[model samples]
Target: MHQLDPQMPPVLVFHGDADKLVSPRQALALRDRLLASGNRCELHLVPGGGHNFGQDVPAWQEKSRALLRDFLARQGLLP
Candidate 1:
């Protein structure tokens, strides 16, 4: 985070609140650092979700797709 660039492209992050592999606090810190660096960042924390949360769940998969679509649209990366 110390080497983050303010002019870098926006970022979309998804982290599981119950993730054991990586802490959710790390994602929060990343979001904060990105925003502090004048970069755009969207953070989504899935409740009761593990490291690979939403990978096997149909509902979560759809939700993730929708979020990605919206994020790309907002960045003008999608039509």
Candidate 2:
């Protein structure tokens, strides 16, 4: 658990507001846990998006990709 180790690396989470398989609240809960442990966490809630953006919405898909890329760059995960 993050609370047992505050030195863990930060995390970036993405959840769709319209997801039916998994609730967005789960993402928020994990983010809260990470933050409570003094670790950095980012959660991006995609509006009108479903799981994996499988709703066939191009705009939401692009937005999700952009957010992911930005997060990776900010965390030095992308070159």
Candidate 3:
């Protein structure tokens, strides 16, 4: 993780409660670790959402998309 290039782009991480593959806590831990290693990472925990995050389209993934849009807008990723 620490080996990652510092020049990489800022990242936004989203996790869902229904994810059986990986615990939501694990996602949070990774986010923390990234921050600790001086990487910019934002994590959002989606309620009633799963690992697939309503896959195939953004509309299908409102929880993740909404959070990401708000974060990105705050970060000036979009006007």
Candidate 4:
């Protein structure tokens, strides 16, 4: 892991529990590291989910979309 800047912007990370290409543990580790450095971070773990979530998008319904919107709004990326 690279050195994190405490003043860096907030980060949102999504990872699938069943992802084969990337380990979800890594995402958690990064989040922890960022938190330790006093950086804003959010981690969302999709249960029984894989790398691709196209099919699961519907399952997520509007919740994920709302979460993204809220995150963006917090960073002043949304009006």
Candidate 5:
């Protein structure tokens, strides 16, 4: 977290709120740290979602794709 550069590219993060493998608080902390360093970040917490929550769910998969597409478009990586 301390090694981040303010000039680094924007970041988009997605974490499952109910994740067991990794605490959701970690994502919040990361978002805070990135913002504190003057970097752009977007964090999304999936409700009732656990680790790899989108893998087996069709709806989640589409949602994830939409989120990624939107993020990329915002970053000018997609049109």
Candidate 6:
């Protein structure tokens, strides 16, 4: 579907190394498809992380928030 159109809304994806529900490698595949069609996208691979980082530790949560804030700010998604 998206392959037929190059212009599309971008999505930011974060994958954990220990995610069991979804393969982290799938993120890369999605990224490749978006890239092939000249669509905007972002991907972040977190190490020592799992499917639920928010339930892991306070530090990880803070770090995740910080990264998200930075990305949004850079993309002008947040004012």
Ranking 3 against 6 by lDDT, winner:
6
Best by TM-score: 1
Give the better candidate number (1 or 6) by TM-score. Answer: 1
Worst 10 residues of 3 by lDDT: 55-64
Worst-scoring 10-residue span by lDDT in model 4: 53-62
Off by over 4 Å in 1: 56-58
- Residue-level lDDT of model 5, residues 1-79, one tens digit each, is 7689899899999888889999999999999999999999999988878888786344777898899999999999999
Residue pairs in candidate 3 whose N, alpha carbon or C atoms collide under 3 angstroms: none
How accurate locally, in lDDT, is each candidate?
0.89, 0.79, 0.73, 0.82, 0.89, 0.74
Tens digits of per-residue lDDT, candidate 4, 4-76, equal 9899889998777778889999999999999999999999888777787535555654666888999999899
Q: How many residue pairs clash in each candidate?
A: 0, 0, 0, 0, 0, 0
| Residue 46, candidate 5: C-alpha displacement in angstroms | 0.4
lDDT agreement of model 2 with the native: 0.79
RMSD of every candidate to native, in Å, equals 1.3, 2.3, 3.4, 1.7, 1.3, 2.4
Q: Model 6, residue 56: what's the lDDT?
A: 48
Record all residue pairs in model 6 with backbone atoms less than 3 Å apart, i.e. clashing: none
Residue 10 shift from truth in candidate 2, angstroms? 1.6
TM per candidate: 0.92, 0.76, 0.67, 0.84, 0.92, 0.75
Lowest lDDT 10-mer window, candidate 2? 53-62
- After TM-score superposition, what is the CA distance of residue 72 in candidate 5 from its true location, in Å? 0.4
List candidate 5 stretches off by more than 4 Å: none
Segments in model 3 whose C-alpha atoms lie over 4 Å from true places: 55-60
Q: Local error of candidate 2 at 1, Å? A: 6.2
